[model samples]
Target: MAATGFGALDGIRVIDFTQMLAGPFCTQLLADQGAEVIKIEPVEGEDSRGAGPFRPEDELRAFGGYFASVNRNKRSIGLNLKDPAARDIALKLADSADVVVENYRAGVMDRLGLSYETLRERNPRLVYAAIRGFGDPRTGNSPYSEWPAFDVVAQAMGGLMQINGPDRFTPLKVGPGVGDLFPATLCAFGISSALLRVARTGKGQFVDVSMVDAVLALCERTVHQNSFQGEIPHPEGNRHPLLSPFGLFRAKDGFVTLAAHFDAWWVKLAGLIDRPDLATDTRTATAAARVANNAFVYEQLELYTMQRTKKELAAVLGGKIPFGPVNNVAEILEDPHFAMREMILKVDHPGVDRQVAIAGIPLKMTETPGRIASRAPMLGEHTDEILREIGVGIEQAESLRAERIIG
Candidate 1:
């Protein structure tokens, strides 16, 4: 748990009705910024609690890394929403919330009588946000609106996979769950924007983000290239389409990325590699000329870089050009820059003997910086506390628990 301190979103409260990566990630951001987030889970618990990379010593194995990483700094309340009593509790929570976020498939919330339209009538100032696979018809209808989607499906359908691999024929899904995460990020932004409007006009609006649409937005360049140049973009290995020397190159020990896209940086890079002649040569003098002779340019650059270690190349090019050593997880854990910025944090996890390091908040504020306040909750860890806070008597809470309505 983090020490007591005020955060940017100190007074705002969020009712999180989300599970898995996309929805949890968005609400986690809000919680990190000090929103009082109440995560309402099913009686059986959120599915991500079973995801692994678990601590071997933990006998119970209540939750795993996947759940822990995104769920820090929030309280959990497990309620069986299928039960009418539990659904009523959820509605009451929403009635007092500043923001309500969910990522269920279309119509699931409506069927439970907890849809945005239903909640808005009781709390008109609610900022309701949804992150769905194909989005809701309230904004725009999609043919795949009712279809289920995961990260891979979104990547494949949204044109990201088509441009992500070594060649056009071999498509690759990105290693990270960006398809879910990007939409979550956009939805978080939308919620913040809507909250600002609510403060100004006292009216809240629906904010919808689709996984496919978010991935497409990330690859917007492809759409314009196809429309304007009549060219379907293909995977160009590690190289950029229009920029020369703007991608990865093999080194003696590992790989390094060099991005000398502009002429001045290109000239400096050529000089640093002891090939000043290439800086003035007609074949590679300007950005356009370099792109025209990309094969020869990359070949010559690789010839010089392949003989040097990543460390040796970094010594010469680190600060001068946009150059970086391609680092894996182990390397990143030891990198000084990441340490300096507090991007790697050691967080305490229950039932785990040692502290676990997770990625830290990226947003830094002078007066009200975000922080990791607490570990992910145990299953229904705060159920009774939350119910009591919301005016449910202890006897009623126990009765609900006995009936398996609240975990």
Candidate 2:
């Protein structure tokens, strides 16, 4: 059979009313799959465009890496939804789209008269998705629904930070913006599910994802540990609570992680280290015993590993065992795996002379592969063409421009 052209979502159109990470990331996933994602932003642009990491040489600093990274493969339209005329234009766009996704607080869309109920009246088959700090009241009422939250806040409240530090007394938020991103990932899945149902039944549904709930779901082990064990799971440093060698290890140049947790692998690892006695020692024999003496186990492992470089360790353990070096961004750029898998991409930046590196699509489908359709658009890049497509005359467009409705 022939492979799918462009992407699996070639025919789908998305009206993206997302500004920052959570919402934009979700829409970006769809855009990667060849959905015609029309990103609706404020007159200036989306909020992240103002955020930085822009090259010092960039004169047209309208957008930066933070915005460009997640916003690739989408068109941008600048509209002031506070204005009734602009709201009407947004409604038209939403009605025309197969999906509409936003990350505004609970009532923001309702205030703008672009609520799901309002749009579903015109397009019953439109999938409406929302990402919120707590959640929409329609699904479940949270006491902190009105409170503003970001990635760290969700990580803290969702039990992830509680079990992520060197000790229980010191909690650490993850290095990444997992709170925003995890919810974005889940919301993307939800939107896809809703779209599938819409195709099958010719009916649309509202897909809601709570940011805090998503974080809690991600740290699901924390819940069962407390319930089943009658004990709270504490910060585990870098090692597993039950497994012996399932976490990071010290190395000469950098760190590496090894996972010789099972008995077979453990014995092999002991033999590799020329410490056969470790396999027979009652203190470090089985998985349970190793866990009981984890501190002693790590100290002994470090005595051997601390003398070798990350590359040297990889040479010994690369495919023979579940081992990986803790690489930074530079190492990742130099690694062959990312390039071979197409996980790192170089896309043209609007003003930058050189091509900028952004992440490539992860969902590899044999029949319908995802692809980057285009680089991220400039602010209001397609306003004229989009207005023309929506049947607005030149004079009418000029009037909207005059009124600061569409940028």
Candidate 3:
């Protein structure tokens, strides 16, 4: 791996008290931007480390793909917060950090005596962020505040599942954990914005993000449509609600998406598909006409598309129209576009015998582009180094380790 030189957030320090996906993912984004993030895990390690796709050859199973992918570019320190000594260590770390992030149930940190209100008293410049299923009472008390939620729960309640899948009657949870990820992404942005305010005012603030709220924000268009038109939106499968020929269609071998929605594009599409007469036909001449006669237009287009292979269709319609073949994971790994853009990266895993390939950073900056500096840390990999930095001597560190206070 290449050195990630002084990045945009080089001077920032983050004390990460997050686990699972949402909070860890938020801190991961900060770490990617060059923040010094110290991930504090329990003595047994973060839960995701046990959630696998583990290497069959590895016996210790220190971490898995789910943990590794979201935890790259950060240091790990295992501390049993159940111990008062460990809690002191965490407070000390937070006192020196510019930001502190957590995603536990609302009162977990309070019970641990490490809540943002307590921590900010020692370090007022600290930006504290929380990611929750509904939201914190500090921001707004949610009816489901105390209820435990997972990705599926957030998707089902937040209106995303209602507008997804093949039809209104059958709603499917999205393949990825967008419910957790979207909230985490928003929390990252909230943290960054809070940091800017701290820079100007020298005062820290609480940043809260709700997973349900985040998902609803992502489905904003649906909310407006329902309010304005009094129309309850439902899944339309592979077709757009208002546009014609703007969705996925079947090719001879696989599937392709062709979006020719404008009047001019509709004419071009008709001519390209050897249906020049359809370009001037009253039923399919204009955008509104094509939408009104959508079934007929789609049937005609499918007849032409099903006769051609994906490559054959692309050859004629690639640049002429908005077209792309549906690519699976295997195809994406072999794609030149992903290679040229560095979207796929291979990283070395310390315990695992083989290298692991994961998705790369998407943000591109001309001067301070983020880089994956290192693979995720081994469990408690920096315990000694961190203890030394915080003024613990070797003998005392050994004593703490022996007592299982620090791992």
User: Model-by-model lDDT, in order?
Assistant: 0.90, 0.89, 0.89
Best by lDDT: 1
Give Cα distance to truth, residue 326, candidate 2, Å. 0.2
Candidate 1 structure quality by residue, lDDT tens digits, 220-307 = 9899999999999988888888789788999999999999879999998898989999999999999999998888888999998999
> Cα miss at 284, model 1 (Å)?
0.6
lDDT digits (tens) for residues 1-407 of candidate 2: 01124787888989999988999999998888878888898887777997978988788887899998999888888899999988989999987999999999899999899999999999999999999999999898999998888999999998899999997678898999999999999999998899889889999989999999999999999888889999899899998886887999999998999998898999999988889999999988899988889998898889989999999998888898899999999999999999999999998887789988898888999877888767888898888788888888889988888888999
Candidate 2 deviant stretches above 4 angstroms: 1-5
Q: Across residues 1-407, which tens digit of lDDT does each residue of candidate 3 receive?
A: 11345478777889999999888888888888888889999988988998988888878788889998899989889999989999999998998899999999899999999988899899999999999899999999988999878788889889999888897678878999999999999999999999999999999999999899999998898999999999988877788877897998899999999998898888889889889988988988888988898888888899999999998998989999899999999989988989999999988886777888988888777777878898888889999888888898999989999999999
Off by over 4 Å in 3: 1-4
| Model 3, C-alpha of 270: deviation from truth (Å) | 2.2
Each candidate structure's TM-score, on Cα atoms with residue i matched to residue i, is 0.98, 0.98, 0.96
Q: What residue pairs clash in candidate 1, if any at all? A: none
- The alpha-carbon deviation from the true structure for residue 150 of candidate 1, after best TM-score superposition, in angstroms, is 1.0
Model 2: lDDT equals 0.89
